[model samples]
Target: MIKKITTDDLRKMQNKEGLILQGCGGDLQEWQDGINELLANENILLDGSKFENCLSFECNGITCLLFPFEENVKLDTGKLAIWRLRSHSTFGGTWLSDYVPNRLGGYLAEQQKPDCPLIGQDGNIFNLMGIASKTLRRNGMADQATEMCERITQTAGSYYEALNIIGEYVNITSAEDADIDEDQGMVM
Candidate 1:
């Protein structure tokens, strides 16, 4: 079974001194070099393997995952793709992107994780995500609040970032603090 690391999981690992890394060693370049060494040690082919491992790290008073997915370094060759997590949505974003995963079977091979991993966000981020989700629901944008939350999670660069974006759509039509009715195209 695959161990899924949620945003809540990252949150729980936080304290005063930022994120504490586990099973990771060396300075910045050395740490990266260590990861490369791990890949070489694994000797796994980049044949689009679905293998993944969560290496935890502390950063800026928060703990984040050093999540690695499988990728092809060369044609018909395989290697482990690595990232600081929280970038699941933008994984393999562009050709110039250092974290770009090799495309196989017409799709970029990436780590299978939640749409809104909330890597950089804290409880405040959670509240922002929730509010965005509720606002979307009250506006009748979608049937499932989970979907709206997922959207917020996927696009929200951070709690403040999402708040600014969602704030635009949140309209108070009356003193009752009622939200606008998107389906009827009217304010309620």
Candidate 2:
């Protein structure tokens, strides 16, 4: 089932709407409004994050700006992204200093990453790489992520594939552009 994680209810929920994503101007609310407009019945590619974590939904069939999204945040799709978002902090809220996700999990509670990491084993990384490849390919990019993945798999092998894949992806991302396709506040 899909749960709507709002910024206000984040503390008391498991899933999140992923409203913490931000960018240069901090005026991304307009972009968010567009996404929110498509909640429930429709979905859209989340703008402003590097991972391309898009969510599809229209309104709740009710009249309200707060859209209820379900199962949208997958590993690379929309699931884990929102999971990671709960670990993030906004102007208010608490994180590592105030709380911790898992004992050994990363404590980016800082909430300042272009995108959340794909946290998992090599297999998970491979799967996530596929998702990113497909999303970017669908977006009409040059498919750089998959291209490098294939290269690494063929030459450096699978052991180094994840590292190389991540290395390649990281090399091209500038801080500002990194979060381009991520959730920069799902306002619409």
> Model 2 over residues 1-188: C-alpha lDDT tens digits?
22333222333234443333222122334434544443322333343222223222222231112222345432233533443355334322122222223322333332221232343323465665665565445444343545656666666656556665555543223334434444575211
On a 0 to 1 TM-score scale, where does candidate 1 land against the true structure?
A: 0.26
Backbone Cα, N, C clashes tallied per candidate: 7, 32
Off by over 4 Å in 1: 1-6, 9-21, 25-29, 45-65, 71-188
Error of 1 at 4 (Å): 17
The root-mean-square deviation over C-alpha atoms between each candidate and the true structure, in angstroms, is 15.0, 20.1
Top-scoring candidate (TM-score):
1
Kindly list the per-residue Cα lDDT of model 1 for residues 87-137, writing each as its tens digit: 235331122122112211122333222222223334475665665465556
Show where candidate 2 strays beyond 4 Å: 1-117, 120-125, 170-188
Task: TM-score each candidate.
Answer: 0.26, 0.25
- Cα-based lDDT for every prediction: 0.39, 0.37
Best model number under lDDT: 1
TM-score of 2: 0.25
